[model samples]
Structures are given as structure tokens and as C-alpha cells.
Target: MTRGNQREKAREKNLKKQQQNKKGNKNDGLSNLQRKEKDAEIMRQKQAAAAAKKK
Candidate 1:
């Protein structure tokens, strides 16, 4: 029983480590160009909405 508990704990620890590694590479999920294009598109939409509201 104790050995089973230890294995479970180790598995949980390994899962947590993997999740942390994935979290740390958040920026790598998008290419630089893609990220910039996404940001620009978001900004463009926001500005257009604001302009429409002003009119």
C-alpha cells in the first residue's frame, strides 16, 4: 500500500513538472509573425468599433 502511494505521488509530481514546462513555453505556441498579426487585427477591430461608436 505504501509503495502504491509512493508511485502515485511520483506520477503526480511528474505530471506537475510537465505542466509547468508547458506553461513556461506559452509564448512559443505562436510564431512571432503570427502573434504580431493577431495583435494588429485585435487592435484594428477595437479601433473600428470605437470609431463607429463615436459617429
Candidate 2:
């Protein structure tokens, strides 16, 4: 009886962890795209500043 209880507790913990990991993976994928866009924006700003200095 105690063994069965332990197994049930372990299973519940693992299931919750799996759910959190899935959500984290989805969020990570979105953050990556945002990071790329931010980098590109920064590069464009630098180029604009350089061009203004040249003018």
C-alpha cells in the first residue's frame, strides 16, 4: 500500500514537470524569434548612426 502511494506521488510530480517543460519550450521558441528581431533592429540603428555621421 505504501509502495502504491509512492508510485502515485512520483507519477504526479513527473507529470507536472513535463507540463512545465512543455510550456517552457514553447516560450523559449518565441523568445528566440524576439531576440533575432531585437538584434536586427540594433544593427539597423547602428548603420543609421554611421550613415548620419558620414553625411
Q: Residue 28, candidate 2: how far off, in angstroms?
A: 6.5
Candidate 2 local lDDT, 1-55, one digit each (tens): 9999999999999999999988875345557779788878999999999999999
TM-scores of all predicted structures: 0.51, 0.48
User: Candidate 1: which stretches are off by over 4 Å?
Assistant: 1-28
Per lDDT, the best of the predicted structures is: 1
Predicted candidate 1 versus true structure: per-residue lDDT over 1-55, tens digit per residue:
8999999999999999999998887456799999899889999999999999999
Q: Flag regions of model 2 displaced more than 4 Å.
A: 26-55
State candidate 2's TM-score. Answer: 0.48
Q: What is the lDDT of residue 17 in candidate 1?
A: 99
How accurate locally, in lDDT, is each candidate?
Answer: 0.92, 0.88
